[model samples]
Target: MKRVAIFLSVLMLVSASLSYQFYGLPYLQKVDDFTLTDHNGKKVKLSDFRDKIVLVFFGYTFCPDVCPATMLRIKETLENLGDYKKYVKVLFISVDPERDTPEKLKEYVNFYDKDGTIIGLTGTPEEIKKVARSFRAFYEKVPVKDNPEVGYLMDHTAYIYLLDNRGLLKLIYSPRKDNPKRIAEDIIQMIKLLKMEK
Candidate 1:
């Protein structure tokens, strides 16, 4: 069945990702310390979360399916971790900055995290572009030919990027795999590994 095939594929990716000592994780490619205006209207830098593990995702408020679903899985991951969620930070970056202003971003992100568990960020298109490029993520706007008033939609990368407490990039998760539980488990293991190293 189609679902079985997808599960198997996700299982394979998860298996590979668990081998943290191997190729599933990123090395020392440091992310740039970019400034962002967060949903709370606060100027935040990526470095602000240095002591916590950061999970970053790129999408827009107008996303029809993937964004919300991915966010839900992330929330579930946090719930699964229970009290340990305090050690993690989730950041949603708007790929469509034109319509996702700071005010709009606050409402959108709050819908997913009423307790302010996730912070949404939007900046000038140029600033967002620089940030996206820094993370090696890509996004583009596709215009709607049928209705001008309907506006446009964005095509973007859907990987959830994980950065360790020390600010080093660790793993990138695929939402389409529908295996966030495994991803969360991997993250917890990584957290333990990091703790032991300290």
Candidate 2:
């Protein structure tokens, strides 16, 4: 019993340490550019979001769990950003553009935040692939027998990438590391550090 208790304590400590690494450190990178159609059918270039912090996620509208959950975390994170909201934008790019029409993406995103703070995007499969490669995001489609529900399911990386004001990569959040409160706190801290730098 004592040995089991000791092991549990050690496991807890390790878990805490990993959590701190994901939310506490500012992991930076230089992401490649992408061009895709926005929810409004406007052609949006990565350069368009320049000079502001951008949180980018790649997922499809039909996603069962991770996508919506991540978006919720993003909304909460923005709420926690306070005045820094003006300096950040959430970009959701769809990998399954074959099914995720521009209008569909728009409605889905608006369902989460109607203020136009989060932008939903879709483009050709090639375009999405380019963006995915740039961000090192993984996505795979598994075909299933004909069903009225989703005929196929996508296994994708459930993550959010935080970019600096200059559109440079700053951090990454996996599903295991994301929560409304944690994401909010992380974004707030990053914005504060960014402000201090500028």
Q: Give the winner by TM-score.
A: 1
Over 4 Å off, model 2:
1-26, 146-149, 196-198
Q: How close is candidate 2 to the true structure, as a TM-score?
A: 0.82
What value does the lDDT take at residue 138 in candidate 1? 88
lDDT of 2 by residue, 154-192 (tens): 889888888866566767777787776677666665565
Give stretches of model 1 more than 4 Å off. 1-28, 196-198
Q: Give the clashing pairs for model 2.
A: 27-170
lDDT of 1 by residue, 1-198 (tens): 645644554454456556743323443346778898999888999999987888899999999888989888888887776666777899999999899988999999888787877999989999999999988998999998887886788999998888876566667777655465666676676667556233
- What TM-score would each prediction reach against the true structure? 0.83, 0.82
Estimate the lDDT of model 1.
0.79
Candidate 1 residue pairs in backbone clash: none
lDDT of each: 0.79, 0.78
